[model samples]
Target: MDLAPFKHVLLLPRVRPLALLMFFARMPPAATGVILTLHVAVTLDKGYGAAGLVGAAGTIGMGLGAPLMGKLIDERGLRAMLAVSVTASATFWLSAPLMGYWVLLVCSFLVGLLGVPMMSIGRQVITALVPESRRRVALSVDSISVELSFMGGPALGVFVATKFSTSAALLFIGVSTLVAGLLLYWANPPMIHEDEVVDGPRPKIIEWMRGRIVGVLVVCVGATVCLAGMEVSAIASLEHIGKQSWLGVVFFAMCAASIAGGLVYGGVKKAPSVLVLLVVMAAFEIPVGLGDGSVLWLCLLIIPMNITCAPLIAASGEHISRLAPPTARGLAIGLQGSAFTVGNAIGAPIAGVAIDHGGAPAGFAIVGVIGLLVAGVAWLLARQRKPVATQTTMAS
Candidate 1:
């Protein structure tokens, strides 16, 4: 609806390139996700269960690796993280196509373990470059760009795999990772460190988690959980209704709504709180789950649920930027990634079991109820937040 948010952030000299770099960097994860499952199930003749385990290994690795990478970035800066991640990632991805099932399991874990820190790095750069007042816009731009990769990468992965070859898809992921690595290396976005405290005890990372930061992190996790659950349920529903082929179109529509919502969020002078947005997101999806099993009904119901997606993420990003101490921003941002990854890991499988027991509606109900519960707690935590950090920062 509005172009100012896009114009404001993109016009920045430093931000423009980093945004482009992130677009490329984000592709590998999405591409590999589809390719890995397809490779294991179709090409290697392994079943879905085995494919799920292989995928889980990578997800678990990422959940653990993101925060660790963030801590290192806080100490060493972005360049060092980029160097290690790019090399490790390139090696792991290139080798992925060659490994047998057992070896592939090991490599997936290692691949996730050494996953490129593009997301953490990109968020840290945004935090450092944008002032607090303008952070909402910056965050929205970042969220929107991420959604583009989120939507396109998997489609591309499936296309290459189906149309050509699985090996070609794997090769594409590896080559793309290599290119993304080089782009990041050249961008080398500078980190801004806080002024040193001469005599006072330095702030601890745990200290930053004292208030709204905790809420931000939890709300983000919950939002992602909903996404993962919704995805699993949608696919399962399609299969049940015998229209599974429409899966790509369904997901693509949702992604488009998210991008549109993100654009509006950035344009608005003030956006709703993360908890409120989550409530809306959770509430809307229930109807989708209860839909009369048809593609048309599913698409109609998903509109409201998809609308809130990127706006909620943008709010969480802005909240963490405000909540964390300037010095530990990278760690804070990284932890956010870790939280989302954990949600990503748990949501689908849990929903899968639910889908099996009572069909897609059951999974949808489970995830929606979970969202409502988490949003309630997030609201409580947010309300309890002391203005201590803002006051202290202002006084200084």
Candidate 2:
């Protein structure tokens, strides 16, 4: 695959620095995913259900709060939203080690609610900084960067907690998150200027949430649901096979496959639609159940299973950027973010319950079936989602 597009994207003004920030900024959350599950399961001696609940709490908050903060960014700009949310996130991360179970759960929800809108902001800035011609490649880089972050985040979280202590790991994440927040605040990223909104009628928020844009989000949510299922199931499969140590490698390889797919997608002249990518992703997920008995086998399966991840993410970001009205840019992106959050919020716990009851095979099947069903829904929606402009013009 060609590396030129990635190189061209990085050289853009204002993009390289934010890309750098993305490296550190995405790590802590990635780490938290691994660390929190380990901390609750290994340290606190909780079950997967409990761990899933905690995980879901954070995602639920993410789902609920992303749009609110996104709107804040739209109305007030990036500075205040970044400052307030990052501070809240830092406080919660730092205090997590000391809190009890219920408190930690509540805190998880609140932290996610208050979590910095980094993904939304980064995409918005990328939309603002790059021209339309380069937007897809830029978002492809963004998605690949996200995969790279997950490569380190969870493994580091698990490693630190294992070598030192969960408390130490939490402290590290807390400090690192604090620094990231500060740096982002200092960076003061740009927002959508929405110059056209100055003279036009204000479009209602629901208008943005329906039709083609929302169809993109449906694909996003479904894809993420598959991802969360794979994650939890992988964790269960590794533990089942007594090769739990290889968990990090499996996640890395899968993410690496996603990166590879994204790079290829970026370089291509013609790409598939988001719904088509989602269908491909769901199709790959079905065989995951067959690999449940062995970690090595599971890793082999994930190469195909993850081939669509980054490409889907890149496409969704591009469409959201292309679709939303200027004034509602933040909210639109925020809604997309929330869809993934909602997927994650529900995905793990459902998979965990499946794993708890019927083991890894069951979890895999559940994810695959749901993914296929959801992809079908997204595809049907996409077909029907003609832009209202064309229909309205035709009608008039």
Show model 2 residue runs off by greater than 4 Å: 41-49, 193-201, 352-359, 385-396
How many backbone overlaps does candidate 2 show? 0
Query: What is the lDDT of every predicted structure here?
Result: 0.79, 0.80
lDDT of 1 by residue, 192-246 (tens): 5233222445468656676567777778878888899999999988998899899
lDDT of 1: 0.79
How do the residues 1-396 of candidate 2 rate in per-residue lDDT, one tens digit apiece? 677977888898889988879777888877887688877877778876798789878888888888999898878878888878988888887888888888988899898898886777777877776776787898888888888888878778878898999888988888988898788778877665433333567567656556577678888889888999988899898898788889878887898899999999888877777877877887888778788877778989888869899998988888877677767788888998998887776677788898899999788778878888887777666666555322211000
Clashing pairs in 1: none
